[model samples]
Target chain A: MSPVHLEAVCKLYRGRQQLSWRRLLRPQPPDPPHIALQDISINLPKGNVLGIVGRNGAGKSTLLKIVAGTLAPTSGLVQVAQPVAAILELGSGFHPELTGWDNALLGLALLGLDAGASQQALSDIADFAQLGSAMERPIKTYSTGMVVRLAFAVTTCLHPEVLILDEALSVGDGAFARRSFERIMQFRRDGATILFCSHSLYHIEALADRVIWLDGGRIVADGAPQHVLRDYQHFLDQAPETQTPALPQAGLARGHAALEQHRIPARLRRIRVNGQPAGQAVELTCLQSTLRIEVDFTSDPSLPAPGVGFIITTPDGRSITSTSTIADGIVIGRDVHGSGTVILEFPDLPLLRGLYVLAVYLLSEDGLLVYEELPQAAELQVHSPGPELGYVLLPRRWLPLGNGHAAPDCKPSAHRYIRT
Target chain B: MRGVLLLLRRLIRAYGQGFYQPWQLALRHRHLLRQLLGRDAIIQTAGTHLGRLWLLLGPGLQILAWWFVFDAVLRVRPMARFSFLDYFLPSVLPWLLVQETLSRCLSLLREVRSLYERSIFPLAILPLLPLLLVWMIYTPLEAAVVAILHGPQAALAATGFMVVLAWLLLPWCYIFSLLGIFFPDGAYGMRFLLTLLFYFTPILYAPQMLPENLQDILAWNPMATLLQQLHGLIGLAALDLHHAWYPLACSLLVTGPAWVLFRRMSIQIREAL
Candidate 1:
């Protein structure tokens, strides 16, 4: 069996409604509304740390709660092959009126330890919490950091088969955070499966073997940490641009287009433009009449300049602009034949709103073109600008004459004034 | 039947651990309970000048007010055989103990819910603490009052009877403690119900003063019977040993179910809190 399996899980929160007393008196069926999770499925192996990353209100905590059995899923099943413990919120079950020693024992008891076992564990937790004599004082007198430290100490002592941490590490000082990380590593070493929810990218990268990206209450991507994180970042960057520009056709074009031929001897794999792969690049419309060029290039150690550049122009081949790695003060020093990607972005186009061509070149520092694309390798059309004037407009200010003053004659200047 | 047995076994085990292992736990983490009690006592009397004395003073003043109102304002006389103070003091003293004990018994779990929710401590002890505090305060005042109104023999006898009654009431205390944790509104409901119970009890009015039919009804109140036993020892009245064993037997019978309810509800209480 999978260590943890969430099959077609769904969660819904009931929104409060105002009902008349008459309606309240006559009971009605609960409303079907507010779906937080829609058919999510996950199968996690034992002893692997999984990090869940999501924007606010994306249902990460709800998913964790369901996994921890603190909450039941509205539909579907969450099956765990091992015992689970959660530090969902630090000091969640702690009593402010109880002493630290009492809370430690209480936390342990709640985790299913008998009194004898809890008593035995309390000393270690107390030492780890480092409250010293303060442990005798009521928890209300303890600082927030002290509370978190005590909670972390007690929770880590449980030795659970599956440990779920939900943003508990966000509290405490840096030293305490470091200590928590060390304890978590120890837990991992004890062959426990961990599901950690955090906004700390560094911690996620350092600890998680796999990462799940949640968007709009759905699992958008799940894979090795680096790959999933890169995809999530790209998703974040592209989502807003796509929404604002109505770029569905552009998306299709970017997905459909393919690289027919290439002269440069570079291994280019998994090329994506505008967040869509190169094989399906045809769907993308170059909205800004500007092309974003990226290529994976590898070179022999002897080659000084294994650089790539691109030129954008009208279909008539009037070159608009071009730049190269050598011109940008980058030096290719080794024949290491190692691979790296180069990116060039053209912010705006001077050409009129019409079809344009893109030309590509791979050259050395001596100006020898190792590879070149003829006049029009890629073609894109720039749609007519709406009512807005010029390529870009500035918000201008004008002052009117006061009542007693005569108005000075003024005319539009030869040079258009643009606000920075 | 098996589930019931299993639940009982578990409760027994839990209670045994809490009672027996407290010293081991306390020794390791010394002064934890003391600190909790101290904080509770201090916060309870923070703004008051008397501070911890309020624990004693508040109840003392309450007794004084009750005495003044009943004797002066109402001009009420004691039963023919008993003086006003002699009759009223014994009844009201125990009544106060029962009220204070019962009201606080149910609230103990709620007032310290935070402690139950967070720590590995057995929650049973939390409810016991409040009851213990009330007992400490009530016991001394009870002795002093009996000594002043009656002779040394009567005072010692009354104290002995009160101690015995307290022991008999342990099961009820435990039941209320658990009820406090499980039922969020248990304390308020108990208070409202106990208000009616106070009148029915023989605290404010002697049972003999009621009509014969009503006397039978009043005698049904376990609190009234307990008070009568207490008053008898203090020489304020004759001991009515007849039907005395009934309330004791009834209390014993009720205790079994009450304990079962407490055990069953404790699990749910942990989750609810």
Candidate 2:
């Protein structure tokens, strides 16, 4: 049996309303619950390292919390292996007044250790925390790094059969962070099933065998870490400087978009490539005529106009290059009717012989919450006549062997097709 | 013992098996529970000059105050066969435990909300916390005090009574702990009510001092029955099993609803926090 398994799990949270005489008399309907997770299902076998990645309010932490058994799902079946230990946050739940030694004892005990095991784990924790004599002192006096060290040592020492971590790798800096990471790697080597949720794609790629990407309480992508991270990284690349906090947080600790169901932020209405009517998968020639793509969208009229973003990637979702109105600080103009049209022109399309997918996204005015995604909406098929190689044709020319002068037709000029 | 076990089993089985969850948490994390209880004591006395001695000193000081008021200032004596000190000493200690436990329940969940936020803190065992702590600290101490005043037999009987009292207070513990989350003002309301109950209990003074009608009212108070049984154990009053009916019935009535309410509102309590 899989160490971690979930079927159609969901968690819903509703904002609390204050009691008032008016509310008592008027009896207004309660606001709709915020969707943390909806019909999320997973079956992670033992020794499988799973990573969770998503934007703020994406319910990655919610899914982790559900699996960790901290938060009960509003609905669905969840079967996880026994003796699950979790490090959901740094310096989580330690009393400031307690000594480091005492805190470790408590932490290990909280992780389901009995008295003898907790006492035995103390030496291991002492070695790992490296607090030395300072371990006898109260935790409040210790530096942030010291607290994190102690917490990490206590959590990892038990070698829990099924360990779950939420951004715990973002431990304190310098040699200790590397040590902590190495310890996680050691756990992986020991065949422990780990469910790691982090915003650091690098860590996810380095550690996770599988990855799940969540958005608006739903799984947008789930597969190999590389593939899922590519999709998630693409979303982040589109709107890198959104107003909403991009920092990942533990489940239910970060603020959620309450009553998100009631709002219609933005939606893609129409798309046209090079003035040709678009199909579900529009195949267009590259390195020939100029490529003009038009996107028509609608937004909530009362709110700020949403941003438009598009990405060109290999068929497997490794992003080649992407552009966004938000990233360029361009304010999309929308009419009072909430309809807006933006046209992107790629002159002298220089993409070489390759099949590329174009994805369109409608971002919220703040450029964080993705309103709609048309993934692989358009496919570009390029077959160049010249004997050039690579995914992109550089704007350059080869000089003749007998002379230093370049051919007149192949002269280098300041153009948009500069290779990186 | 067999009869008691049968009733306990019936109670657990009656509560829809959710009763077992708290038991499981308590058993699985018993070490954590012990550590947390120790931590609570450490936090109370950590910075203090006297340190762990303050556990007894704090109570000793309160007992001194009560002694000064009732014994010296008011010059109150028991209306029954025993002296005021004999009756007051045994009963007042348990009342103090009740007062502290019920009052402490007010902010119990809130105090640990941050802890539960980032970890899967087993909260079902929380209400049991105050009870267990009180039991750990005072059960032996109170029994010792009873032994010094009475004899070994009375001390043994008082110890059993204290144990039963701890078990019986579970419903009250859970009720107040949850009320502390959903209705914070209930703490203050309970405080005032407990003060009223303290006067009515017959712990401070004997029941014979009150009017016939007020004495009848004291029959419903569990603390009164506890003192009566304790007094009986010391050979100061008649030992009758029939008087035990009200307190047991009261526990059953309170526990049935308290456990159900906790099981139902356990999730909501976390949200409220």
Against the unseen true structure, what C-alpha lDDT does each candidate score? 0.65, 0.76
All candidates: DockQ = 0.12, 0.43
The runs of at least 3 residues in candidate 2 whose Cα sits more than 4 Å from the true structure, single-residue gaps closed, are A17-28, A240-420, B1-12, B15-28
Question: On residues B73-97, what C-alpha lDDT tens digit does candidate 2 reach at each position?
Answer: 9988874456677777888888877
What is the C-alpha lDDT profile of model 1 across A155-250, one tens digit per residue? 788677888888764335533544566577778898889898886564577678999988777898889999987776566555543212111121
Candidate 2 per-residue lDDT over residues A1-420, each given as its tens digit: 899989998888976654545677899888777989988999998899999988888998778887888788889999999777787876678999999988988888788788888788899999987789999999999998889889888878867778888877636543355467668777888888999887657568877899998999998999998888877777876764643212212121111121133234556677777665444444444455566789887666776788888877777556678888888898988887677888988776777778877777777554444556677556777666555677776556665666676565542222332345
How many clashes in each candidate? Answer: 33, 0
Candidate 2 has an lDDT of 0.76
TM-score of chain B of 2: 0.89
Tell me, what's the RMSD of every candidate?
17.7, 15.6
